[model samples]
Target: MSTAEAVPKMHKACVYDQPGTCSIAIRDVPTPKPGPNEVLIKLTHSGICHSDYAIMMNTWRQLPVPTQTGQIGGHEGLGHIVKLGEGSEKLGVKIGDRVGVKWVASACLACPPCTESLEGYCFNQKVSGYYTPGTFQEYVIGPANYVTPVPESLSGEVGAPMLCAGLTTWYVSKPTVPVLGAGLGRMIYRLPELTVTAVCELLIQNMINIICVILEYSALLKCGASPGQWVVISGAGGGLGTTAVSLAARGMGYRVIGIDMPGKKQDVLDSGAEHFIDVTQFDDATIGKEVKRLTGLGAKAVIVCANSNKAYGQAVSMLRFGGSLVCVGMPEGEQVSIANAYPSSMIMAGHNIVVSAVGNRREAIDVMEMAARGVVKFPVRTVSMSELQSVFEEMSQAKVTGRVVIDFSAA
Candidate 1:
């Protein structure tokens, strides 16, 4: 193993001392050496996402198991490599290089999802701060090939949230092209003379002219709206919501309508939303009607970024004909489907409902580039390790605005 400096045997980490509650405790844990194709990172900052709070409180019902006691909890980590495992240099990562760990900590590249450029949903994925050891510590190990390189111009504090919140919301407003030749094997089986290479070349040539049409029809374009179209962002004042608002408005040219409590109005507007709706002042029916009135025929898309079940229930009603509802937030407690999605209305309106996981590695890099260019900026508040519990409490009450990042240097 290659080392940049003297390695320490122990490091400080924040752990969930009591799982299923908003409690955190700091402890000195033994640091381990990096295995083959891995590198040890000395984390400098970690963004506290609502997903982390969900894991800590055991609120997300979809998780296979409850979070164990003493588990470290954080996924959006930015740090520098301190040690490299055997053969890790082959991956072009070295000691002292800055990298970030994402929600999908590691994915087996040979998996079906990974092969299709959807590593975020890999079957063998290791989710940071879930069952896997996460980045709430001063030191953690990450796969050399999977770690995302941090741009020199992006500060660690700003880059930390981009790994999760920014990545998850960045792609909501952008268009996603469907993978070419998705079911070409079935066609080849029927016609043996057609080779894969020739078929791919023909498909590529034929697809060039219809790319714009495909964008409208592509199932992968979860938020199916073009530039200047109205897009409603529910829960648009929280960490994930604000980031989504900024990327949708400033980065992608969409007119954003942010919905949240009256307290979050300034933050939502500051994040670049053209209009803000205070949920406390309006009922679900009134909110839907207001959105329709503001957007003329209703919004072209609705992105539910809040974890509230009520937000999901009201989202479908705020869309125009052929509009999409991109679900990004994970609601706590029992799982529930979108409340207002009636089959009769959905079929007539040609509405689509899709859920988005944290983005793939390519999207992660793109979000970092967006931040580096100043096209998107996170309103961040840096806090010490001891303040983690209070942060979670505020997050649960929906009182926290923008993003809260933990500065490990303070630990």
Candidate 2:
């Protein structure tokens, strides 16, 4: 194994001491050696995501099982590689290189989804915080190939949230080309007189089309929105919401309307939303009407980034004809279908509903590039590892404005 610094026998980790509740305890744990094709990272900053809280409290019913006691709970981690196991150098990573671990710690690259570039949905995926040891520790191990490379110019604090929140939002906002194989085949069959050069051009286009499609499941394309079209972001003040708002507005040229509680109004607006609606001031019906009022027609897309069932219930109503509702948030407890999405009404309006999870590896790199270029920025506050429990408490009460990152350097 290649090592850059003296290895430690133990490291400090924050764990969910009591599962099914908002509680945590920091303790000294034995540091683990990286196995084959893995690298040990000395985490510097780990962002606290709402999903981490859900795992700790066992609130997400869709998960196969509840979080276990003593499980380290964090996913958005940024750090430098301290040690590399055997054959890790073949993966193009080395000790002292900065990398970020995301929600999916690792995936069986042989799985069908992984082969299709959907590593997030791999059948044999290891989630970072649920059962596997996550990033809320001084040292963690990640697959050498899967860990994202951190840009030289981006700091660990800024790069941490991009692993999850920024990546998720950027995956949907980026444009992708439609698959063109079938179209190319039909053109070739119909126009046999086409020259060899023309056919080669078509094949090249098809290849680029497939590759781009695999890279991103473009939510804006699914919403049928063009640049300058209006889009609504529900829960636009939280970590994921704010990032989505900035990427959609400043990065993609969309006219954004952010919806959140009154406490988040300024943050939402500052994140680049053209308008902000306080959820406390308007009922569901009135809020939908207000969206229509501001948009002339309704919004071209409504992205629900809040973990409220009510946000999903009101999303479809805020869309124009043939518009789309992109569901990104996972509400706690029981799962409920989107209200007001009657089959007849949906059919009459030709509205579409799309669901997006964490993005593929290519999308992650793309979003990090965007972050490095200053196309998207996250408002973050750094907290010590000991404060994880308090941060979860604040998260449960909807008190966190942007993102809270746990600094492992203090350990």
Predicted candidate 1 versus true structure: per-residue lDDT over 232-264, tens digit per residue: 999899999989998888777689999998998
What's the distance in Å from true for residue 233, model 2? 0.5
lDDT of 2 by residue, 205-317 (tens): 67766566567665235446666799999999999998889888877778999999899898888889999998988997798999999999999889999999999999988
User: How well does candidate 2 match the true structure in TM-score terms?
Assistant: 0.89
- Provide TM-scores for the models: 0.89, 0.89
Q: Each prediction's Cα lDDT score?
A: 0.86, 0.86
Candidate 1: TM-score?
A: 0.89
Top candidate, metric TM-score: 2
